[model samples]
Structures are given as structure tokens and as C-alpha cells.
Target: MSGGRSAQAAIAIILAGGRGSRLGGRDKAAITLGGERLVDRAVSAARDGGALAVIVAGPAAAVPPGCIGVREEPAYGGPLAALAAALERPEAATATETLLLSCDLVDPAAVVGRLSGARWPAGADALVLRDPDGREQWLAGRYRLAPLREGVTALGAVSGLPIRQALSGLRIAWLDTAADDVADIDTPEDLDRARARSELGAD
Candidate 1:
């Protein structure tokens, strides 16, 4: 991990350990898109977007290549708890900002692009991308680490703290993206649709 460099934009982390009951219980980050692993897509996009360090937060089952592995600290708790755990990652100490990955998006690079061009205002606690389709996706977002830690601690469990709540005392930026961009790989139907779309060159 490098710090004090003008090029170091933020510390990026991918939340990949979700037990994907969708997509036939397959690991979403490991899912392939355009012949490249989804997690790899995320890493590449994040690095290209200026991440100084990249971390993968997920289960021990199978991890994608080219990232520092991170698991939820509370083991099986929700995202907030999982992030708190990830924040404690040895490599996380140098991260100025942290990114939460949905692990199953069709366009990770687009997601990163949406976030990179956003205006993270002063007092802006965190920024969550609004998937124009209406889902408030936690992944594909930018976070101000310091305030997140405070809110998570004050709110008790990490899962208990909502992104809104953390930004309650601060400003938040929303980067709108296409529905297909944030569409997750959940269920065989979704997977099939993804494959079908891939064949059709849609998305």
C-alpha cells in the first residue's frame, strides 16, 4: 500500500463474501463477465479509478485473484458489521476512503466511473450510488471512513447503521447509473438473463 502520493485516491474494498442464494448459490464475485472474473473486473476498474490499495471482503470458500482478502469480523453479521470487520484489516489502516462492492454487478467499471465523477462535498459522510432502477445499492458506492466508523460505533452493530444515518450529520452525493449497471446476479433467471444479454451485447 502506498500513501502520501498524489496518485493515491482512496482505499477500495470489495464486499464479496455474501452467500449468494441467487445465481444457484454461486459466489458472485467469482462470476465471469466478458471472460474475466467479476472481482477482477472490480479490481481493475478501481485501480484505474485511482485506488491505492484494493481489498476483497468475502468468505473463505474461494477468493478472486489480485486483492487482499478480508472477512466479516463478526463472522455472519450484516454489511455494517462486515465493514467494521473489514476496516480492521491490516491493510485497511492506510485507506483514506473505502468502497463497498456489490460483487455481482454487470458493469463494475461503469459503477466506478459513476463514483469517481461524483462531488463528495464537505461534511459528506458517505455516498451511495442510486441505481436509476430504484434499488439503493450499498455496493458501488463511496464512503468517508472516519464518519462511518463513528456512526457504526455509535449505532452499535454495523448492520444497524444505515448509510442514510451515517450521512445524517453530513452531506451525501448520489451517482445515478443505469439499471443494468447495478443489476445483481441473483437467481438462475438473472444469470440466464445476464448470459442472454451478453450474447445480445446488451448492457
Candidate 2:
């Protein structure tokens, strides 16, 4: 979907500033898989999915050209705070929908494609991916901008707030998908596995 009309109405917010405690505090965004940085992969996925604007909520230095970079107050404030910070940007205010993604995905393009192609259910505030094991991948979803903003507003001072708590009242639609589509790199072993999968040309 190369900037399709429907996708042009949506903006993407990538959460890339997490402190990778499991990986000895390394910068997850900078980590490479398939010879490309994770953050770069995320940017490519967002663009490929036809997002009108791509915003990376992380260190300004990690931000790639053609994408806006924002950081949550005090840094590492948590995903909800990152979302709040991104929503404050002008691009987000004008978007009809929001595509949220994290930088650690092993195959972000797969999830992005699914989200970009799926029909938004009437009356649903968000559409999230449900793994084969039935776990919701909150960040791998599409959200209606109005309800998402309202949810953020309802939770004043989102710093350090749990994402589920901030978005508790919204109506959610789930899309079931295979486990590999939702894989993320959190530890060294995970990174190794991603590299191995990449070598095998698995998506």
C-alpha cells in the first residue's frame, strides 16, 4: 500500500525509546536485524503502510530523516506517556486514525500490512492484534484519533501510566494473527532468533 488514499488519513506513532533492561540497557532502536536498524524497519513499515505522517517517539538522534521525533517528559516515562507526547504533535491532531507500533518488532511490516488492510469496525475505538496464544498486542494496532485522544485526556499526567489503564474504557476490536507476526526482540536470544529468521528469509 504505497500511500493509498485511505491510509493517507492515518498517522503512525512508533515507540522506540524503551530502556532495554533485558538486553543490558542497550538501545533497542539501534539494534539491527536483517542488516537494518529496528527503528528504520519500523519507519519503513509505517511508510509502506501509507501513513500520512510518521512520528518516532524516541531520542531525536535516533529519528530518521522525513520522520518527526519526540520524547516523553523525563524520558522512559512509559508507552502511554510516549503516546501522549506524540498526540501533542500537529500531525496527530489532523489524522483521522492512528497507527501505533513499537521499534522492537521482528516483522513490523507484516503487522502493519494487516492493520492497513483491515476494515475498521463501526463503533470500535481501536483495532488490536491478538496473537495465536490470545494475547493482545496493544501497540500493534490502529486507533480512531478522537477516542484515542479522549483516552489520553482522561488520564491526566500519563507519565509512568500503564497503557491498559489509560485506554481501559475504549471499545477494542481484535484481529487474530500468528505468533511470528507479533515477535519482538527483548533479549539477546530473541535478537539471535530474529537474525536467524532473517537469514532464512522468513517474514
Candidate 3:
């Protein structure tokens, strides 16, 4: 533990399997913000957050250096499927916690650091970040790996399952943060905003 924080070592698994239909079917993970691909930024943030390892759940070829990449079965499977696949990997098996993130976060490292540094309530299974509007950013959370694995195992054949369905019963602790911290790039205009924010050196 760092300064009374949880001692669990974290493995970051970034979900990058989205079809990006809103971005004209382009690979959103490869989209650039301030000259850096979204995937690359996510990887760097995870590292900065003290992740023991980083994995990208999507096209292997597109992932940044120093990160492993895996894909869910039946390409285009939803985030839950990608998460399930990530949990099965050897790195995750050895990890005490998992930092789950989507590729489009503008400040993933900050979210990861905040969640990792928090002292979760006794028996809490996860720590999820929430926007100012009180909307949970499910993908931007830190989960106890054992509970996560058990949850996934309890729901058999999770391929294509919606995240809300797959993770419904877990005990989640929510931390309310600025909307910008949890904002994601979905459309081109969102990308533009993120780029502008990046140029401003905003987290």
C-alpha cells in the first residue's frame, strides 16, 4: 500500500473493441488527440497510475509499445465480452485488482490514480468514477480481480452481453468527479473538443 492505500497490485485492461460507428467506422482507439493515439494515451495513463501491466482489448496491431493486446471471440463483441477475455489472461490471473477503462477517456491516468488511491469500503467489490451528473462511468473503474473473475464466471457465455447486465449485482463505490475527467470521445466534435483540451494541457 502507498500511504495507507490498498496494497493490491493493479493490471489495466483498456477496452478498445468498439465498432466506432459514430466515428464513421474508423478505429477510434487509433484516433489522435494532440498527436497521440487514444490507445497510446490510455496506456501511458495506466502506467502513470502505477499499473503493473497494461493490456489493450482490441486489435493487437494497433496497441502501443509495452502493452499486450487481445481480442474477444467473434469480433465486435461488446465491452463485456472484451472484459471477460481480459480477465482470462495470465496477467489478470496474477493481479490483485483490475483497472478497467475505455479507449476514449480524456484523463484516464487521473481516474486510475484516484480510484486506486481510494480506500474502498469494507467488502466493496469495485470503485467506479461518476460524472458531475451522477452518471457512473462503468468502464472507468478499479475492480477487485477475484470478485470480477467470480462475477464473470457466474454469468456463463458472456459474449456480446451488455456490461449493465453482466455486472449488475456487484457492490460498487462511486466517486463523483468533474465531467471532463470522465468524458469520452464518441463523435467528431467530441474528438475536436478533446484535441483542444489536450492542447491546453488539461487533464
Candidate 4:
């Protein structure tokens, strides 16, 4: 179970429900890097990595084919709420685990493959893909459904809660990966850099 494949039947949950305020309110998922939208790239990577299901927690109108559409409460609720909404789906509860991904990943395949094939300790609640600088990309993780749901439920008022708050106290295993592989397009400058990287075929 290595090299882009996983023994667990994971469900990929792409958090595309953000307001994209940093990019002047533009839809990050719809923005094109190179020739493909970020959401499309994420969906492709999840499917390519052997995810049995792909759930996009954002605008249904923008979601690409081969993915299901779901939005969080309050229209622009944060990732926490968006994640809660995704968990309501039957697949999430039934799947062995869930792969949580932000829609703005620059190299979803590399990140997902690495995380999926990494060692998951017996008691570890989640496996986070950390950047070279050691910053945990909370969204780039694989979490056990039971632990994730327990975490989310333990913290009341999940709507509008920060992701860190939602996932606090869970035993996590971090896989330090190349920063470039986990780069996320959050601002206009980030978008430009991603485009430049894309043009150079640097993943």
C-alpha cells in the first residue's frame, strides 16, 4: 500500500466553501492554474489516489464531474462547518477514513499519495501532511471518521469554529513534505506563483 495507493477506502473531502476574501472574493476553486481549476485538480488527485468517493463542500454549481456537491451552513461558513456538512453525508460515516483537502493545493497528487501511504500509528487520530517548514496543513490530512466526528461533536457550536479548534487534542502524525508540494493559492500573489510554477511544470 504505497506509491499513491492506500489500503483504506478513503473518501476525499475537498473544502471549497471558503469566501476567498484574500483573492478579492473570487472563487478560488474556479480560478484556473495552468489549464485546470483548483477544484478539478483536487478532485482528479483524490480519484487518482484511489478515493472511493469525492465530496466537494462548496458551491454545487462549480463542482466538477465525478464529485458530489454540498455546502456548509450560513453560505460562507468556515472550513469547520463545511467539514461538518460533509460528514453528514452517508459516505463519510461509512468510509473507513476521510481525506480532507483544501481546494487550493498546488500538487494534490504528491501530497495525497504521500499522506495516504505514510504510516498511521495505532492510536493516531489523524495523519497531517506538514510542510518543509513544519507548518501543519490541517486540511491536508487523513482522519479516522470516528475520531473526527468525536472531535467535532465534543466541541459544541461547530459552525463558524476555527479548524484548529475543531481538531484540537487529537493525536496526529505529521509527514514533513516539500513546501512546494503543499503550496496553497490563498492570495493574488499566491495565484501568480502557482501559475509560474505550473508553467515551469514544477510540482
Task: State each model's CA lDDT, in order.
Answer: 0.69, 0.89, 0.83, 0.85
TM-score per candidate: 0.82, 0.95, 0.93, 0.93
lDDT (C-alpha) at residue 175 in model 3: 86
* Residue 44 in model 4: lDDT: 88
Ranking by TM-score: 2, 4, 3, 1
Candidate 2 stretches greater than 4 Å from native: 1-5
Best by TM-score: 2
User: Could you give the candidate ranking by lDDT, starting with the highest?
Assistant: 2, 4, 3, 1
TM-score of 2: 0.95
Worst 10 residues of 2 by lDDT: 1-10
Instruction: State in Å the error of residue 111, model 1.
Output: 0.3
Question: Which candidate would rank higher by lDDT, 3 or 4?
Answer: 4
Give every collision pair in model 4: none
Query: In candidate 3, where is summed lDDT lowest over 10 consecutive residues?
Result: 1-10
Residues 76-135, model 3: lDDT tens digits:
888988988888889999888878999999777777778767887888888899898888
Top lDDT: which candidate number?
2
After superposing all C-alphas onto the true structure, candidate 3 shows an RMSD in angstroms of: 2.0
Q: What lDDT does candidate 3 reach at residue 33?
A: 82
* lDDT (Cα, 0-100) at 94 in candidate 1: 60
Better of 2 and 4 by lDDT: 2
Clashes of each: 4, 0, 0, 0
- Which segments of model 1 are wrong by more than 4 Å? 1-6, 159-170
